[model samples]
Target chain A: MRRDRIATDSGRDVTVVSRNGAASARDAAAFSTRWSYARKRQLFLGALAAPALVYVLAVAVGPMVQGFLYSFDNYNLIRPGSRHFVGLDNYIALWRDPTARSAVINTFLFTFGAVTIEFVLGLGVALLMWRDDWFNRIALGLLLVPATVTPLVVGLVFKALLNPEYGMIGYALAESGLSGPRGLLAEPQRALATLVAIDAWEWTPLMALILLAGLKSLPIDILEAAAVDGATAPQRFRLVILPLLMPAAFLALILRMMDAFRVFDIIFVSTSGGPADATNTLMIYGVKQGLEFFNIGAASAVSTVIVVCILIMAAAFIAVLKPARNRHA
Target chain B: MPDRARLSLLARRFAICVVLVIALAPVVWLFSIAYKPTSDIFASPPTLLFSPTWDNFSSVFRYFNLGRLLESSLIIAIGSTALSLLIGVPAGYALARSTSPRAIWLAYFFLIIRTVPPIATLIPFYLLMRDIGLLGTWWAVIILNTALNSAFVVWMMFAFFRAAPASIEEAAMTDGCTDFGAFIQVALPTVVPGLIASAIFCVMFSWNDFLYAMFLTKADTKTISVALLSAYGTKDISWGTLGALAHFSTLPIVVMMIALNRYFVQGLTQGVH
Candidate 1:
C-alpha cells in the first residue's frame, strides 16, 4: 500500500513540474524575458533582502569605515573646522597614557572575573534546577527577573544599596566590621570587584537559563547507562556529560565575554569608573575621550582597540572549543 | 540508596531557593526603597517596613518630567521595532528560502554585524547626525536604534524561517500563487509567533538602551535610562525619587517578560538548540 501511494505521489510531482515548465515557458515567451525562472527567483530574493542590507551598510558598515579613518586623524567634535591627519598619533598616545593602560587591564580583569563567576554560578543553578517540576519552574520564573531588568536600573539599585553613608549593605558591612567606611564602590581596592559582582548578579540568570536549556537537552540514555553500570554521579558527569556540554558552555562564555568586554552602563552609573579610576574599563574610557574630552580621534582609537580585542578573544574561544565540538560530534 | 538520593534532592531544592532569593533581592530592595518616605530612605540600616508613600512617584513625575521621557522612550522603542520588522522579515524569509551560497554568507554577515559593539559606531554616528542636524531628535535615536535592531531581527527571524517547512510555500507557489504572494499569504502567518517574539526582543533592547540614548539624545528627547543616570549624577542624590524612577523604567519590561514568559524563554533557548 505504501509503494502504491509513493507511485501516485511521484506521478503527481511529474505532472506538477511539467505544468510549471509549460507555464514558465509561455510566460517567458509572452513577455520576451531574458532571465530564466531560477534567475528571476534569485532576483526576487535579492530584492527582498536589499532593504536591510542597505540599512546595515549605511548605519553599521559605513560608520565602521569612518571610525577607522577618524582614529588616525585629529578629529574633534568641538574643533570640527580644523581637522587634520595625524597617522597613528592617537594609537601612540594610547600606549603612553597610563589611564588607557589601566583601562585595558581593568577591562580584561572585569571580563575574566565576571565571565568565570557567572559561568560557575550559572552552571550550579542550572544543575539544581535540572529537574522539571512545579517548584523548579517557579524558581526559573523568578530567575528571569534579574536578567530582564534594565542594566541601568540594576546599576542604580546597586548604587543605592552600596552607598557608603546610609545604604543598607554598606551600613551592615560597616557595622559588622567587614568593610571600611568608604564601602565597596568608594574603596579604590574593591570597586572593580564590586562592578564585577554587580554584572554577575544581573547576567548570571541569563547564563543559567542558557545552561539550563543545554542540560535539559542533554542525552539521558548515556547518563542512565552510566548509572546502571554503577558509575557514581560525579564520575558520570565528569566523564560523559562535561564533554557533551562543552558547546553550550563555550557559547555562553563567548556571549558573556563579549558583553563583559563592553561593560559600560553599570560602571557608568554606579562608579563612573572611579574611586580613582579603579573600574575604568575600555568603554567608559572611550566615551570619556569622545564626549568628555572631545578627543574624537583618541576615542575612535580606543574603540578600534576594543574591536580588535573582542575579535581576538572570539577567535581564541572558537579555536580552543572547535576541536572539542568536533570530538563530541 | 533511596534515602541518600532523597537527601540529595532536598539539598538541591534548598540551593535552588537560595539562588532565586539572591537573584530577586536587589529588585525587591529597589521596590522597597521606592515606596519608602524620604525620612525612611536614609534611616540607619534602611527601613524595610514603612508607610507606603506616593511622594517619590509624585516627585519623579512633577520634577523630572518623567512622563515626557516615557513618551520619548515609547516612540523610539515602537518606531525602531516597527522599522526593524519591516526591513528584517522579508530579508529573513529570502535568506531562509534561498539555496545560494551568497545567501548563507549574507546571513553570517548579519551575525557579524550584530557582534560589532555600538560604541564602535558612536563617534561616526555622532558626527554624521550632527552634520545632518539630526542631533537631539527622536528620529536620530529611532533610526540608529532601528539599524542596531534590524541585524538582530534578521538573525533571529532567519532561524525562525529556516525552521519553518518550505514545502507549504512551494505548494502555494505551485498552485498559481506568485512567490511574494506565497510568502505573504502562506509563509508569514505560520511565523507569527516568531515575529511577535522578535518584536518583543527589539522593544526590550531599544527601550533599555542607555549609551546610545545618552549620547544621541538631548534634554528634550532623553530616555528614562539617561534621565535616571543624570538624576544620579546630581550632588544631592535623592534616593527615593531615583528609586521610583528606576521602578517606572523597569516595571514595563518586567511585566512584559512575565506576560510572555514562555515565548521569551523559548527565544533565549532557541539558538542553543
Candidate 2:
C-alpha cells in the first residue's frame, strides 16, 4: 500500500491512503475520507472564528468607517439638519488652528517624555526586584497598586495633593516659595511637564511590572555564563541581557507609547487641556469637540488624525524594533 | 556573608523601600483623606495627625448612590468579559490550531484592532447606539467594550493557545475522541491560566474604563469611575468624596491584582513571546 501525506502550514503531516483504480473511483475514495476530513476541519475552524470576526466588523469596524466618512462633513450635532460635506477642509482647519497644532505637539512631547522616563525607571525597578524573595514579592504587589488606580482617580489624587492653598505638598512648596504662587498645575510653562510627571508616576509601576516579568523570563544560564566569563554586572546587562531582552522592552515601550500618546483620563480630569492650552492633547481636543461642543465633524477629523498618527508610530516602532528581533532570532 | 555582599543587599533593600514609598504615597494620601476630618483636610501646613471620621464615606453614599454605581460597573465589566471570552476564546483556539499561513496575519489584525483610537470609533458608536435606542444603557457600553476587548482576548489567547502543544489533542483524537471533545477536555484544560488571565484583563479594562462609561451611561447607569468624575468637578473639588469613591473604584481590582499576581505576570510575558 502506498500512503499519501498532506502537509499543514504548521508542518504537521496528515496521512491518507492512496488507492490504485480508475481515476474517478480513486477520486471518490479520496473525497470521502481525506479531503472531507480536511474540509471538515477547515469548516469547523471557520465556524469557530466567524462570530468574533463578524462581531468586530459590525460593532467596531462599521462605526470606524462611518466616523471616517463623518470626518469629511460638517456634522455638528447641535446643528443637526444643516450638515454638509467639505473635502479635506477639516484637516486643513486642524493645521490652521493653533490649539490643534499645540495639541499635536503636546501629544508627541508627552509620549516621548513619559515613555522614555518610564522605560528607564521601570528597568531600574525591575533590576532591583530581580532577586526573588519574600520582600521583593511583597514589594512588587505593593508597587502595582498605583497602576491599579483609575487614571481619572490618579489625576484627582494628584490634583488634591497639588492644590496650592491647602494641599500638603503643594501648600508646603508654595509657602516655601519653591513652586509658583498658584501651583504647579496653574503655571502654563510647568503644567504640561507636571502632567507628564504625573503620567510617569501612575504608569511607571506598570512598566516596571511588564519589564520585571520580562527580566524573570530571561534564561539564567546565559547570565551565569556571562558572569563566568568575567563580565561585570553592567557589562553583562549591556551586552548579553539587553540584546536578549529586546522583545520585552519593545513591548513595554510600545504599550506605554500608545497609552501616553492618547493621554486623556488624567489630562481630562486634571488640566482639562489647560493653563493656556499647555496640555491639550489630541484626545482632549477630540473629546471637547465631540462631546462638549458637539462638533462631530471636527471631532471625527481630530479622531482620524490621532488614529493616523498612532498607525504611523506603530509602523515606525515595528520597522525599527523588528530588525533587532530578527537579528536575535 | 562578606561585608561587601551584605552592604549590597542592604542597598538593594533600601532602594526597593524608596520605590515602594514613592509608588504608594499618592494612593495612601488619597485613602487618608477619606478618614480625615474635613477641617484637617485643607489645614495650611497640613496637620500631621488628626481625628479620623467616616463623614466622607457617608457623604459618598448620600450623593453618589454607591450601590447603584457599583452595580452598573459590575454589570458592564462582567457582561463584557463573559461575552468577550465566549466569542474570543474559540477564535483563539481556531487560529492556534489553523493550518493556514494567513492565520498569523489575522492574529496581527486583532492586535491592530486594539490600538484603534477610541475617539475614532466612539463617536459613531455613540450615534449608533442612539439610533438603535440603546444609548444611556449598560448594554450600550457593554457592546462597545466587547468589540474592543474580544479583539484583545483573541490576540492574547492566540499567543497562549499557540504556545500550548497540540499533540495532546491529537492523541485524544487517536484514542477515539472527537476533535471538539479533545478541545474541550484536553486543550481547554491546558490553557486555564491563560483564560483566567484574559478574563482578569477584560474585567480590569472594562471596570476602569471611564470614557465609554461616561459617554454611554446616564444618571441611572453611572459606574463608579463616572461617579468619581462628578466628585472632582472644577467647582466643588470634593477631595474627601473623591477619595472615598476612589477606595471603592480601586479596591476590587487591586485585590484581584494581588490574588492573581502569578497569572498577570505570566499572561503578559506569554502574550509577548
Candidate 3:
C-alpha cells in the first residue's frame, strides 16, 4: 500500500492498493509512505553496495575459486592439468610431512608471538603518548615512519644492520653483551623471537595509532568522573578504558595476527627461511613448495589451510565487531 | 600534590625526546656506516666520531648498477601506484553513487580481499607469473602489485567518495556534464586527499615489498629491495659498498615520506572516522 502510494505521489507510477471497505484515505496515505520509505531505503542500500559486489567477484571470489579448482589436480607448467582427480593426497601429505609440520609450528609461533608482543608494546606506547602534548604529535609522526616503510625494505635494512661482521646492530650488541654473529637471523631458537621483535617494531606503531584514535574518541566524561572519584590510574584503565577500548584492541589483534602469520616479506628479506627452517612460515613454505619447487598440490594444501585460518579469524573479528557496532549505534 | 600534574607533563616531554632519539639512532647508524671506513666500522669500541665520506655512496653506483636498480624499483612502485589509482578511483566513485546492492557487496568483498595476507598465494602467484612468461617482467610486478594494492585503494577511495555530496555531481550532471564528466571534473578534485593517501601507501608497500620482488625476478629485473638482499652474496659483501647501496636505496623513500607527512597522518585517521 505504502509502495503504491509513494509511487503515485512521486509520479513514478504504481499499482495502488485501496483499503476502501474499512480504512480512511488518511490512514491509507500514511500506510503507503511507510512501505515506500522502506523500499527507498532498500534501493539506497542496494545501490550503495553494487560496485563493491562487482569488485569482490572480480578480484577475490574469482581468484580463490580459480585457486581451489587448480588445487585438486596437478596443474603443472608443462602438463597444465591432465584433468585427473587426485583426491585428498595433498591434504594427507600436508599432515604427514616433517617440513610441513615445522612450517605449521613456525606459522603458529610467528602469529602468536608477533601479535602478542606487538599488542603489548603497542598498548604501552599508546598509553605513554596518551597525555596529549606537542611531544605526542611529534612522536606520532616520527614513529609511523617505520610502520610506513615497506616490510621488504625493513627486512633489507635489518639484514644490513644485523650482519655479523659490520652490521651496526650486531656490532653494538656483541660489544654490549650479546652472543653469536647476527643472532636475530642466524640463531635457531632466537630467529623466530627476533622476527617477532622486528614485527613488533614495525607494526606496534600502527596498533598505538589505532588505540590512540580509539582513546581520543572515547567519552572524556568517564575518565573525568573517575578522576574526580579518586580512581587510581590503574583502576581507571581497568574499569573504564579497558572496557571501552576492547573493540579496537581486538581489532588490532586480528589485524596484526593475520599479517604476522602470513609474514613473507621480512622473512624473505632477512633469513630466507634459514638456520634449517627456523623461520619458515606457512606462507613462505607454501611459496617455496608451490612456486619455487613447482609442487602445486602441496602449495594448494598450504594455501587452503591459510585461507581457512583467515576466514576463522575474520569471522571472529566480525563477531566481535557486531556488538561494538551495536553499542555505537 | 595537585601540581604534580605539571611535573608529569614535563616528564612526558622528556620521555618523548628520549624515544625519538632512540628511534633515530639506528637509522643514523646506517648513515654513519655509509660514510665510515670499513676498518672503522668494526673498530674497537666503534668510533662514533668518524669523519663522513662519500666512498660508500660512490661504490654503490660504481659496483652495482645502483641507478638501474633504483629505476627498476621506481618502475615497479610507480606503475603499481598509478594502476591502483586508475582502477580504484573509478570503482570507488561508482560504488559511492550507484544505489546498487550488488556493488556495495562487491566493495566489502574487495575490502576483505585487500586485507587478506598476500603471502598465502605466493606459490600460485609464482606459477601464474611463470606460465604467463611475465615472471621477470615489469608487467608481472605491476600486475601483481596492482592486484594486491588495488583493493586497499578502492576501500580508501570509496570512503573518500562517500564524504563527497552526491548532489554536487548530480547538479553538474543536470547542468551540462555527463555522469562520467561530473565525476571526473568535480568528484575527482574533491577526493584528492584520499587519492594522495592511497598512492603514498601503494608506493611504500610496493617499494618496501620483498617477497614478490624476490620470487618474481632475476638479475635483469631485480628491484632495489631485492638488489639489497643480494648485496651480501654478490662476490662477498664489502661493508663499505653494501652500506652505500643501503644508504642510497633508503633515501628516496625517506624523502618522499618526510615530504608528505601530512598525507601519511591523514591516511591513518581517515578510515577510523
- The lowest-lDDT stretch of 10 consecutive residues in candidate 2 chain B is B230-239
DockQ per candidate: 0.56, 0.61, 0.33
* TM-score quality measure for candidate 1: 0.91
lDDT of 3 by residue, B1-273 (tens): 677987987787777677667556656665567788777776754466787788777777776887788889999999989878877777777666655446555555566676666644555566667777888887777777787687778777776887778778767866987655787798899878888988998998888876778778788888888877777667646656766776657766776777887777677656544
Encode model 2's per-residue lDDT on A11-52: one tens digit a residue: 221222233345546555655677677778778888889999
The residue ranges of model 1 lying beyond 4 angstroms of the native Cα positions read: A1-35, A314-329, B1-6, B235-237
Quick one: best DockQ, which candidate?
2
Order the candidate numbers by TM-score, best to worst: 2, 1, 3
Interface Cα RMSD in Å, per prediction = 4.1, 3.4, 4.3
Indicate the docking level reached by candidate 2. Answer: medium
Residue-level lDDT of model 1, residues B1-273, one tens digit each, is: 699889999999988878878888888887777788888888877667799998888888777887799999999999999999999999989898886757756876776677777789988998899999999999888988888788888877887888899888878887899989988999999888788888889999999998889989999999988898888767555788887887778889988987887778877776434
Residue A217 local lDDT, model 3: 76
- Of the two candidates 1 and 2, the one with more favorable DockQ, higher being better, is 2
Q: Model 1's DockQ? A: 0.56
Q: List model 2 lDDT by residue over B12-65, tens digit each.
A: 999999999998888888888888877888787777798989998888887878
List model 3 lDDT by residue over A35-94, tens digit each: 675565456445434444454455455556666666676655546556466877788888
TM-score for the first chain of model 1?
0.85
lDDT of 3: 0.73
